[model samples]
Target: MENIISDATRRNWDRLSASTDGKLTSRANKQKSLKKIIPVEYLLDTAKIKLIEKICESYIGYSIPEIIYSIAVILLQSEGICERQSVQDILLDFQKENSIDLIQIDEAIPRFSHNEDFLGALYQSLLSEGDKNKNGSYYTPRKIVNDMLSEFDLREGQCFLDPCCGSGAFLMGVSTKDPSSLFGIEKDPIAVFIAKLNLILLYKDIDFIPQILCGDFLQDEVFFGKKSSFDYIATNPPWGNKTKIVSNLIDSKESFVHFFVKSYNLLKNRGKINFLFPESILNVKSHKVIREFIILNQDLNEIHQYSSSFTGVVTNFISMKFIKGIKTSVIKVRNKNEEFYVEYTAFQHTENKVFSLLKPQEEKIIEKVLSKSAYSLSSSEWALGIVTGNNKEKLKSSDGPNLEKIYTGKEIDKFRLREAKNYIHYDRDSFQQVARDEIYRAKEKLVYKFVSNKLMFAYDDTSSLFLNSANILIPNVPGMSTKTVLAFLNSSLYQFLYEKLFGELKVLKGNLMELPFPKIDSETNNTLTMLVEEIISEGKNNQKDIDEIIYNVYGL
Candidate 1:
């Protein structure tokens, strides 16, 4: 893990060095001079960042603590002679503790974006593998933050809140000159400390003090003292978190959605929200409620959907703007490519309220189809495959006489289930009951890949068990055969509907439940069944064959 991180850091540094030709840290560029002494950049894990926070938590101290305390004194509170002396002492102590022979504040000033950026950079430097998944800590890049702040347009008195403000990046990004009323809440105290410093540096020479504190916004009612109070709320809330049954905010299990709901509630009637959220919010099944809420209640302004917005973060995200009271009259969408940003107009409908990147006509066409009858996948009995806590220890490559064949999602394609690469101990004690083991024991059922870009399912009669990545569904629909259902799932139209309506890569059971399968006559079903048999027998995708029949049956 260390080596992987080291390599990633090395590659990033090389890219930076090659682009700037060492100008970023050349002696001629005194601010960048630190690069000469320490050639490579480092990242901090949550533990190390927390350690620094502890060292700096003291009221009056030297070294790291002094820098922390001085920032809090001069920036958070009022300016005074004692504060100035303390800051000077802190800097001197920091230099001495680091074993630096000399300190050149002017020359070193250019290396950092701001005094607060020093901590921001520190957090960026010490990351280890899987640290983000464990801690949910990822610093927002300055460029993105600056662009969002500039676009949001701060006012002298309008309030600004960054609900999950990390290192106070969004709070610091606010316009310091004509600063709005500042407020932020962070769950991580280390980040809260960093934010205090960053905001102080941002608001330097300005009189307004930022009110940034540490607390879980989801769990704490104290964070929102009054309803509909804030003017603007902005932040990239913590990703990969789960909510714990908060009132109106707990619309979904996902934590970011809770932040969105809470932030929306906190805003004044006409107040605007400028936030960064995963693109999945537009179409994920679990987030459907949130999407419905947005469509029904909120008004859109602009959405900036960026591909690979953050280099290491895997999920695509959007910078969204929404107004609380008005309907979205004109919506602009800007997509970020590797080298350029392209803009598109959001497909608007007079009556429907679907916010997606699809063109107007495409949305219109889909909306027209959706206006008809559709059934939920939940109408059927669907069960999740077994979640063996430790696959490596539990799974066997060579089957025993008693062992049962097991297939994972990777082994299942559109029409065929490949040979099981591993076998499971099907003994009564082996399979832990997650949903219902009896569902897997069904003699005939359809299994589909749980996490896939497109729907991929196959009819199974072997009563074989599968791992968690593959899920089983027994249809409850009266006439739709397993073959016909599989045909619809693999069809292009279904793919388009799933992608646009529910944008999650993971094909959840909820997404299936809401799908509208066109009712077909017995004759049409026979033809589809025949085609499905041919495709499965031949072990090929026969997508066009299935789609042509299905589309004609639907009279599209």
Candidate 2:
């Protein structure tokens, strides 16, 4: 379809919206509001004038919603497809509405038909964002759908499904010669109507007809009757944030996991399921159980992740594929042509932790360090700073008797601290969530940028308070002192290990706990402590001295 909508009938379609003056005001609002839950791509193309005319002939005097629904029912029934009893009941309810102005299908059909997705685009412009979020409905972009189709080679006569088929984009993307074997299941009545229309038109040129059932595919009935029903399934299920987990096995309460489990159960033994999911599934601690299940039971294929792939939504996205009954043995990773392959494995030993995957040499080096005496960074004394319930009310710019100098992540660098930008009015009876008050009052401590792109820690002997952004850490390692631990954290080798083990921009405590710290001898620890003193006294950014000491300590 062409991009531009010719001026001949744009006004009529625009005026069909709610605020516009019209005799069919209430009915127009219903159609406009219905647009939010229905994705634009799932709606059938309205550019075919002849197809529209033929469809309008049978619905000459029906209401807009009724006309569209009736037209779809006629097409599907003619192709020998049956509607569920519940859907048939919905059609019965549509017969009772007496539309104020019965649509003049002959006169308006031409205006509604355009060179683009005329009806879908028109509905999107008329609806609001709040309406779109009503049902956790988000239409997949064109390029994203294309990329998914490219990854799978659909063979003729293979049974396929879009379990949550919104407007049938996946079904339409499949250009297989046989549409008779294609299938889909959708719970939304409006979406089911639109999907049927899309498939009807898509298969109009061929002898094939698709079966898109209007029912929930996760029901026990579906499992018993339709188990192992398809060879391929592609869908973007609803991410119901407010929904609670019905099954206790899933650690997280997200609705996507339920959809994945249901879809997997319905697939053939060797079938593949491709989906677009929230990025949290890859590394979030809450999803560790599901991650283990997929890795152990399924042949995890590939993952393409990105931040903010959806224009209006703030969540990150990842595209992945899973082949049923296949366990991953060999894994490789690389970022080629902007595609990042997420591989969290190296050598024969690996952990189910975020960013644990490393390059060959990096794995060898970390293994060598672990082979010797060492401990996890968790053994160190660490405490998060005070989280002021209301920073504006509790924080003061000028120093007072009770106010203590505080620093944020921005005021700290490698082995040195910068000038204070703010101060916290500390009191025993203050409105602060003091997690570790003793750590806040300690005389000698090490502080690092709580939210840093890299490891940035500095030493402070004065008992200074810090904001939550600059967390405090005091080492309790038997052989290493506070200064030695600070040097190791700020060294180049530790920074490299950190980035390889956990690539998160924010240096969360979990990332710190995962770092493998080597137990250096007394001489090595003393040398690192002396280098730390030089870097702090001179206030220089040079890290070569400290880095060399860390390298020798690790025997790198």
Candidate 3:
């Protein structure tokens, strides 16, 4: 009997692990394929989604929230924790207006019932991407929840809260000795109901109610007088939400900024705040206000950057932790492959208070480069390329009457401009966004790619017009000629400096003004000009000699 039982158990495990192709899969590959647990995978599957959508279509009069409420009712009933009437009474606390008939899907209960936040997952999946982006609602994966929770050193009896909780993922991950200690505030009412239900299922034996509120964290009355209440706060605040809330703490339009400033107010002394944010929070110019607030106000503890992103979001993200106290002098940073520390003072020196995660050697190099700087491009004249609102109608590949060649970023190579491929009529009034006539018709100006990871400037004397992808820079350096300044801008040394200092893909005029221009003698300037002219006249990138000269000027 023992031998038979062992064989049967082995066969059952094999069956469970086999793929649709009848091949045994590795555990890692299987887990990766699922991306989530079994219950979540079931909800995300195509057949189940179609069934839910079909039911919604048939019940045309019912709304999505009402359908989701009915599903939650059935989920609770299947758990045997509460009867249908009891579940309905629990949902009433959320003030839901209507609910659909559960009897319509009576036979499908087994397929939908699971030990998970099934209703929340269904509602999120059903929502359009446009709506989700508008609200900045992206459900955090369980793996990320577990990873972020591991950072917090929790103690018994400490209260935890997730300010922008979506279906209680962070709250669910909080390992509190008392379930009631896990608190959350979410704006979505259906999500609030599901969060409470999930907590109740997790702690079925407990006799306490879950303190999950359904209201905006920024404008709700519940958060107005709740300063210094929570021992810990962890959340993924809405990204790029444009809802304006009046606060003098941080001046920004993004919703995440508003949520962050408010969360700081609600933390107890020595309490921690762990937030997952878009990578822009680290270095983007527009988000500088919050970075300043953090540097001036709180104890910035650590930053953990991740390469992975949410399902539809293209932006990479990072997680940061803060304590409610006087900020220390250094912040710990953890990347995928290494860990390091950056001085808090370094951010103060930067114009935007950007968090520059650099190695000690790289930081020293930047300091060395900036120390010998005598001038910057801030004195130069800058202009953007033309922005033809309707490019298809305005631009033509073939030439016609009054058509002029316009260069794009792809046509602007280092030290030389490639032949123009796009033709447009140079009508100043017809374009949506155009530079002044004199700027476009300059005798000699350097054009560079507006969106680039590195510098790609080309000297143009053809009085050329450029599309929006290219930008014009006419240098105003006192000691250097146009070609000499072009040499430094196109050199490899400046590329390294630009990438380390700004760390932005878009080459904005503000960032360009920060690049240091070392004062050079007339002889050195003339030598650089001759080298740049050689490369341009030959139409070849003779980068070696030109880069050497600029490297000597900066003493790199």
How do the residues 24-128 of candidate 3 rate in per-residue lDDT, one tens digit apiece? 454433312312111232244445645554664565575666666666666666667665454456777544344434435443743233234456666665665
Q: How should the candidates be ordered by lDDT, best one leading?
A: 3, 1, 2
Query: Each model's TM-score, in the order given?
Result: 0.68, 0.77, 0.84
> What would the per-residue lDDT of candidate 2 be over residues 412-531, giving only the tens digit for each residue?
877888988787777746755665667867877998886677888889887787777788888777688888888878888878777765656678777777666777789988877887
Query: Which pairs clash in model 3?
Result: none
Which candidate achieves the best lDDT against the true structure? 3
- Cα error of candidate 2 at position 199, Å: 0.6
Model 2, CA-based lDDT: 0.62
For model 3, the stretches where C-alpha displacement exceeds 4 angstroms are: 1-62, 83-88, 92-96, 106-116, 223-228, 388-403, 424-433
Ordered list by TM-score, greatest first:
3, 2, 1
RMSD of 2: 8.5
Q: Rate the local accuracy (lDDT) of all candidates.
A: 0.63, 0.62, 0.75
Clashing pairs in 2: 42-167, 299-326
Q: Is candidate 1 or candidate 2 better by lDDT?
A: 1
**Residues 1-556 of candidate 1: C-alpha lDDT, one tens digit per residue:** 2232344344544543422222223223222222211112222243433434343343122343334433444333343322444345544544455553331111112222452365654443433324444455667766677767775666666788888987777877776455436788888765676675565556555544457667988888786455337878888877775335456655577777788888888888888887788877765545667666765664866778764334334466788788888776556677644222111223222112235566565665566556554554567888888877888988999999788899999899777898889987876456565556678778778999877878888888887888888888988665777788878887888888877765666887866777776666898888888888888787666678788886676557
Residue 234 alpha-carbon offset, candidate 1, angstroms: 2.3
